[model samples]
Target: MDPDGDPARRVRGHGLGLVVAPVLRDYVVVDIETVPLVGTGPEQDIREIGACRVEVAPDGRHLVAERPFHRLVRSEMVSSVWGSGLSSPSAAAVDVADPDAGLITCQAALEGLAEFCAGRPVVAHNGRLHDFVVLDAACRRHGVPALHDDRLDSLDLAHIAAPRIGIELRPNADGSMPPASRSLDDLAAWFDVADPRRERHRAVPDAELTVLLIERMLKTIAGSEPVRQLQRQILQTGRNPWARFLEPPPADGSLLDCLEADTARMADSSGLSSDPTSRIGRRAVHEAGIHARAAVRLDEASVLAPLSPGGALVTGEGRAFRAQQREMAAAVLVALADGSQRESRSSTSSAGRLAVEAPTGTGKTLAYLVPAVACAQARRRPVVVATHSKVLQDQLLTDIETYRKSIGDIRCVLLKGIANYVSVGYLDAAIEAGPEGPIEALALAIMAGWATQTATGDWDDLSISQIEAAFPPVRELRTRLSVDELREFATDQADRLCFYRCALDGISTADIVVANHAVLVTLDRVVEEASHVIIDEGHNLEDGATSALTETAGSVALTALLDCVAHAVSGAGVLRRYAAACGASPPHERVDEAHDALVQCRRALTELGSHVVDYVRGRTEVTVAEAASFGVSYRLRPGLDTGRAEFARARRAARALADHLRRLSGCLALEPPMSALGTRHWRHIESELGGAAFWSAAERAGRGVAPRPRRCLQAAVCVPRASVVEPSEAGVGRYRDIGRGCR
Candidate 1:
């Protein structure tokens, strides 16, 4: 049994290949350090390489009995690339005096690593983005074929297994913060893995630390068998075990299908059995219902009595709650659960709305959450908590877990927009397309592990940007899909349920749904589900709404639109894949025609964007000052006429581009015989068409071809604190606020 032979086998249940644990007991851990120099001409110089062989016992014990392979690579090749002298630090780190005499050459080091990793899974922390890439680059530079090993990123595994720790970003010299480091040293310290090394940057020590971290994480995951069982159940059943708590019940069987498909894919990959069972049993369900019922039975007098002035307040933990928090909770509970205070549905203020402001240390989240949960349980109506930031959402999720333990089993879920999740069908397609490079291969591996372990398909739990940086295609495949279409492609109930869970489908059924304000405004289903809404950081509402309503036809948008057309034309996207599967070819001539129109439109948009930027710069007399909310801003140049001609030209160009998009959408609509698989792609294309229509309408309105109603543009631009000066009496007013930034 070759553990690394089949990828499907490796990424099955718990992402640990539990079915083939015995065969996967032996593997090598590898790490590499590189000095990246300026210039793209082969400047990656490998300073060191490290490798360790380990064996695991069936009891989950592991040993690194073999002597580790550690080597310092010669840096003479690096000197050639950098022109003469190497950096002092680089020179000191290597045997530069007689570089090749004692040290291994890059080619030799890579070959050694390949031999060591051969027929065994190779593990490293962030190997996909850093170590593995560096090693592959070195191999390419030395004319060696890349190493073919079953690679597992311990970093990816750690995120799935260990407790999530907040990444603290390091402030730059300019007061901006650099992306936080998830380095081996930092993670080891986080996991409390001892490393007594005097210096931490060395390849060998880091590799050893990575192995230790992996062992620790594996042990922790193994110990949590019940959670794993629950996850497996979710996969097999295509239903969240706690879904029974949902009001009206989640009617969509599609969610279960989607979740089960994902589970089945994972199981098939790892040769694990995908057989469903009554393993969860009636006892677990009975206990959960009991807990939920008990949680909702709070005596109004008993709960509200302590919250009165001069009365001691207590939490579910028996600790004395803060007075301010208690008071706030009392007010919220009265508004929500108090029948006497509950207004008639037809009343102007019938909806329960309570605004509370307390200092930071007052435990505002818990204060509102306790009452909200109690109210929701009592009324059997879901509560939606709208947050302005991901930080608050995470904090709320943590607090919700605490409440669940102390109070009762409340089904709370975090809801984000579709863009945050990777589509299972798309991901599977991308992997099957056979990633052409090492980075892409690594991305596939990482995603495989993540798919099996992730409860919510949201990329928030993974290092998404890092993965995308390693392989750009991963980002490309993250296209949003409609819930109904996702269900169609979902192979089983598990896949369907997973999709529903992540895409905010059936979210209304949750006891408490935590969502961002952006989701509230854009995803109508979210707002429609809740009987009451709690907006945390309520003061940001105006700004959030402003952002939600704003639109900008900027360079980024144009480029992305062009890319979409290009993908469509080349028959290289999800739609094309589905079309192929259906034995259908899209109307190639029509697509080509649309593609040509988009190309011309893109050129025009580019020109228009530049003209708009120049017009803004020329009209503003004052120096362009950077505004925190509005980016760069300046007052109109004194005595300067508003650039009416420029505005008209830009508007014309935008309208033309929108027309081109609409034409392309029409072409896609004429698609040949499509199967159910093609439905998702068709829907996405339709969405794109809808966007084009919106832009066209907006452009027409801005150009005054459509009704201008209140002439709100002029009012907005003339405001005293407006970022840009008022438009002149000329028609420039119509196009002055052309590109409003939106969330």
Candidate 2:
């Protein structure tokens, strides 16, 4: 029987209508093979076109109907485009049809392909980068109208559906190099989708494989309730749920109104709660009461006694507590609760600070937490638990939950910087602007569901890097909202409002506030409010402090600043617009002077940064060694001095640039003509000047050869010493010398 005549091989036709539907309809999966041209022109040719129409059941199972549409188009451009007569291995891989066998012209093939697609949404693997570009170029070259249907990329879908199977590198036959693992064949194998064609790299087999991959991907997404609800909302509204946030708010009311209405409609139809607080509010309140009662019961003896070894207070669940842990907890509790302990000999009362040193697996987290929570409860002040790493923060959170059950319900909140939370207003603005690509649309969809379900709007909870990677514009959209704007937007939704209140405004009110050291150190108010603070992984404190305090005028940063100034001088950046709005055009001569100064500063900084890198590399030889207990150690070569002249020159150039910035800002801040916005810009420029000064000061302090006002720690060195060791039954081993002779 002829393959085209067989019922199983026949293509099923579906009509395309722009109507809202709860289920997807009239979808096509397409793939094309093409010969790439060396130069830009209509000099490339499409070798073949293959497509499969997909049908979805009401229950979410999808079927791929193999009505294969295959076409071979003749083109004279191939020989000229390939220059070397198509002798490349990749070119030789393609199976081209015979020119004498009545193959259709390029125009005819595209027209036939368009007819087959019927204006339906098309799906293709890596379509954004490869397939779509080829098809559009081929259409343009042949004078055929371009396919205008909505396009989706299976490559992006694969990332969302099977995130664990990231692109891997596989060695070639000669083991010379490894290629990126994004091929259709590799992806098919990864997803366990079957490709029946005997030869790979052909259009038809790849198209078929893509359809099977889509089937598996959709099945996985459909299995997830959050994703499925979002999918349905997108289909039913005929507007991408995530993209809708980018839309402009209604003129009469706030953006929050629009978000609430959309969320309420979705919740009503899908039976999901728009309010996350309803799920956890009552328990949170009850827990607060439990913590309050528990706090009142804690005195010095009660707090310290339970932690002591073999004490009567160690009965029940506390029996397994270690002696070291009990001692650490007692020290922390005494420092936190006793005001007398805070009194120093200098006649001034300073807050008592305690540092506990314990090795790994010694229950440091619980030891600190038990005392911190009890002290916070007794003192009626928040206890800040700051960690050095996210791993420790997550582990502490897990332990906190365990403690909540074992101890009492203690109210806690995880607070991060403003950048970590998504702003609904900014998202609305982006939605109004409209997403530019399929990946962006997908990211918006995922975020839409998260916006409703997430109580904190924290990016960490969702843990979807693919979404963020695909749509980086989300980061640009994370603008800082003013207090009034935040309150107005959060007024209608209790749970949404709670996030801002607990995480930002009322942070001091929470029984326990968990954060990273970066947040506590940067935000002084947080540190000031905490009656008790526990710095977990305190061994990393010095390094963390250095990183936070140090400022360097690097080449990349200088280049970016120079570019911004260039744009402003050319009347293209925010500064130019602000000046124009203020009805005072900056003097052209002043702008030119500022621009010239910045260019010189950038050159000096670049030279200085490169010299610093080379100097450090030449002086320091870092060697990794295994420690006796666990982890690794870094040994740095010592007694190397930095060039004083080089440091002085860089510092002088930085100071000159900062002075220029200050002068320019003063010109812009002229009182009579400058508006509030213009003044804000002036202030911003002043802030930049301040930053430059700070960087210069840090550089001087770090590398200064002469006596200075402040003394800075320049380097950390690990010294090794020779020791005589007696061989035991186990073996001979090296030991650290702790005596005066080693020093």
Candidate 3:
């Protein structure tokens, strides 16, 4: 007989189409138990076999018709403690007066069962584990493959049957029916059906109960749409319902059409306009195999698109090409060379600020790169390029390396955070010396692992766990070796960098410093002096700056500080003894200072947060004497009074910190300067505690406290050149600038 032409095979073929129809076919619920199962070896013998077959009605009435097949065999050893609860009870429980006669009866029953389920697919409750035990053991001993390969597991079916409930065959911790893993008898009661087994645990009755439970489950599931989808996944791919059904593309479909279709779908899903002229829109139309599209609203989208394509060279000569290179190196070069696109850089004084509104697929990276380098060469100042993503960071790194090789002797450096870079020297030495104890040993191992990947010298390679492993007993160890201890154990050995040293070199004086937005914002805030800065991925500027300035008073952060204090006090035991040896007071002043700051900081945060909430939602509108409502001070600007209130609390906290530092300067003294306190801490103190002088500098950078009269933040962009306007909007990039702030 042809297997494909068989009735059972024909019924399965119906699944290929997306329609559901009932078919006449029997399914068997088969289960098996193993012999010598107490041992841990892979192979085991089949001690018992059980099966019950059922037929599905066309009207969806699944009925159990056939008597079940049951078999049991004598084994050399039966573990009563473990095997007593299993399907085939212990040999002691068996009513076998004659073991030899029982073996013959069991073998005959197994043969009959196999013959009965000849062409039908068998269903089992976790059939994979049970069926494989029987199939593998029997096939090995009998020298023949056992039964069919297309068996279905009821455990999987039960999961599909109950879409909301997850599948598990184990009883719950409470010893109750765990929703989905209920026994066959309990399951039958769930559907309010009469069980023929009468609570019997024998093989034949259990199999019959399984059939009845499945019939009820199928009936319950057939009514739900979600269950139908689950059934589709089970029947089609034997995968979860979460898997998408990817339909094939239409015949004779062009790549352009696919792009258009996809773009349309994306536009719909994102709630953006599918039309090209919409405020937020994407147009993907292909011309001669080249997809010409724009994703408006995202500043980087226009520039990033073209760079993604192979063999696509971006020059500012063409419309489609010029649109993509905004802010990237290539676009920057063209803007400097071409007068028409040069006006976009009006906001920055050193060179015109290139605000490339390029869509996705536009070569924005190249646009900024070429023009920024040109501006840097023209001005003789180091151009600082900043991006948001680490991927873009690596790309810019490669770009700079390529430029150094091709575009003359220009120096560049990729500056990541110190914590991100691993210290290979420290890690290697620590591992070589080994650790003094468990914590130290764990830390050493972490450093060893970090050293292996310290190729880039970046600490971000390992997760928070790796960081903890590198510095074991992180909360306990302190004194002069605290920093050293963590550093010694850090898996971040491979990615270390001398940031301050690298910044001060003559030959190595970086012409371009590639960093992230957060790093750049920090540099801007800390460094009083300004340099030529080209903000790449500028769309993220507002959000990044806000995050840097924002403070959150969360319990976790509060708890961490408390833990730090606890660790410091605990670790001070050794420090106190050392101070005693030198005839000095304990360093309790640091704890006192931190405690005072915490109390004031907490109070300030609570008061300031309420004020900010009011400012964000409050309306300042009022009716004028002329019986007409006049709008005044509608919104808060950078220098607005309301905005100032939002930051008033943080400012007070900052001032308190500065005052605490003054007190520290007068009282706190170190014995030979704790080696744990690095230059970074001192620098932070010097900058943060320097008072009103820093606030004046910050005010100049549009970062001062918001003032009363100017209640809204307004920015004006002035470009000196008429030709700098993008071709899409001719004359829009001219010498004049316009902007207004509204509430």
Candidate 4:
């Protein structure tokens, strides 16, 4: 029999595609115990099957487990736990019951378990990840009904319900995270329930324990029916809500046409404008050479066609082509084209700004975006559209996709500062360090799950009120480390930056880069490539600019960076690892120099924070109560001498630490390595010490002129690498990932 033709094999193919599964009132709880089918492979033969049929009472007030099934199965093959370790019990533990309860055949056991399921949904503690996975593999080897039901995991429900109901997971005894070691044991301990069998986990007892825990969690959240959040997650087990980004490109044989997704894309690309009402308008643009892809010249009539009544946007796209929208778009189009020509003609020319004070319903966002996208495509340079607020940036991004789909493939991206992304390496560091408290634990667990599933690698979506109600650690996760950093870190380690989908370095060729004004204020080197700039909501620009331009060495930021530096130099840190990779440890005195400088920097930061606190206390005009009610504002006035000495001290200390770090990096980089992966690591450090994440003031050439720091965070650190990881393998020219994530 062809395995591909197997029905069970087909089911497992789409297992990860679960958007939802029906949640029935009654279900079967299954727990299976198995050992490797051989001395070496992943194939496992089930040694025991244990299950209980759970039923919700007619009134839906309680859960009941009535029919129970247990079997010690006979196997033709001798088995051991092998390298699987504690995940499976040894054969000795399996036979602890009387040495001869007389085992059943593999076929008999599977048939009996399927009968026990009796056509009900199956629930288990981490069933989808473990139990059924082994079962499916076993069934494939043996050729039998796999008994795969609508699989549900209690572990997912616990993660969701823990915070809402005030529950904390019992951190694992080995100090590792649960869910790898995720077990019925943790849930049983939390709910004060335990597996009933005397020796524990003889199968049926474990199933009973899971059923009880699920009941407790479900009932605790609400009445007999599970709370909607819990129910949604349980049904959609693998479909993490955070895993999604922009609407998925249409699927195969989609309803609209043959190979509809491709057809739609072709239609979108084939014309300068898809507006059916503007056929005559497009003909005129084509004659003006404006409808041609790169030959698209920015002209008023062609640019406004897609935004006016005759455009495709008025039909399937929800936008009604308003005359004012067209008028504004036309005005902006002419100004941008004229300015672009002027700038190309002379360096000092004023690429002027045009502002429109139009009514609220005039479709102002589309007005600017239309001209911007058209001009960018025409001029063959990225156009940057800066929104005054994050909300408007998001809204404008949506508007571009919605209304402007007819205008064409505007290869646009929402380019944000690196802080808006979470780094996978740092996330692993946080989990390995363990959360400081339960709220932190819950947030970490949710983040870990989101990292696996997210396409955008966007930061935590927690609302402001939600973040404030939680602890400070949630904010820490949000600010430090990003996916852009991992591309470099992983490159040196030769590890796949696989877990994150934040397409690292994807924005370089994007036709339009939508950014917030704060990003614009940084004068981001990437945004500097823009041929045209569109500033939306100019009314609020001054406030956003002033707030962004203000410099502050935040207590939170300073401490987080300090922690990363400390971790890199610790005894088990990257220094030791890098030294070993290079065939020798640094001289003890040299290593000591690095540690001593780090210590001084920490002391200086603490002193600086203390000085600023004291200075703000007496200098601010507003009272503390009023400040707390609104927000804290303190201006650092020069010559007023508030904390100036402390600031100078801290900067010097930081610079000293940086200097020592560079000397060590240069020492190690000069030493070559034995293996391909190690060679890659050494060359990365060897090349970038001039000014990587933790830098030395060693200079590097930018052109034959302007110098730029060759940035790198230590191979171990994740926070500041900001897409500036420089990898130089000999004869392969230096390339840097400016870390612009594109969707």
- Residue by residue across 93-162, what tens digits does model 3's lDDT show? 6635555546533345456667878777777765555555555565656455466765655544344343
Model 3 misplaced stretches (Cα beyond 4 Å): 1-331, 336-351, 370-381, 389-395, 398-411, 416-437, 444-458, 461-497, 503-508, 524-532, 550-554, 568-743
Candidates in order: C-alpha RMSD to true structure: 12.3, 16.4, 27.0, 20.5
lDDT of 2 by residue, 535-557 (tens): 87777876655544433322333
The candidate that wins on TM-score is 1
Winner by lDDT: 1
For candidate 2, the lDDT comes to 0.48
| lDDT tens per residue, model 4, 1-743 | 22223322111101134232222456778888776665444466788889888766534333555558888886545433454344444454555554676687787888888887878777777665568777777777768788765676666446544422111211121122233123567556656665454357568777777777777765543322212222222222333322110111122111112112222332355443332111111121222234345547555656667776778665564557688777777677766675444333222224456667898998888787777877777776778888897777667756765554466565555555555655545554434333343344445545544432233344523222243332444554454334332334545211333223222233444566677787776645556688777888878887777655542223344345444333433333333433444444343344455556556555654454443444444444444455445544444444444236644543354344445434434433333445413333343333322223433212110111111112332321212111211111221112111211110
* Worst 10-residue lDDT window, candidate 3: 708-717
Error of 1 at 495 (Å): 9.4
- Candidates in order, TM-scores: namely 0.59, 0.48, 0.33, 0.44
Q: How many residue pairs clash in each candidate at the backbone level? A: 25, 7, 59, 5
Query: Once superposed on the true structure, which residue ranges of model 1 sit more than 4 Å away at CA?
Result: 1-128, 132-202, 205-258, 261-301, 304-321, 339-353, 418-452, 480-498, 501-509, 521-531, 567-571, 574-587, 620-652, 674-743
lDDT of 1 at 473: 54
Cα error, residue 676 of model 2, in Å, equals: 13
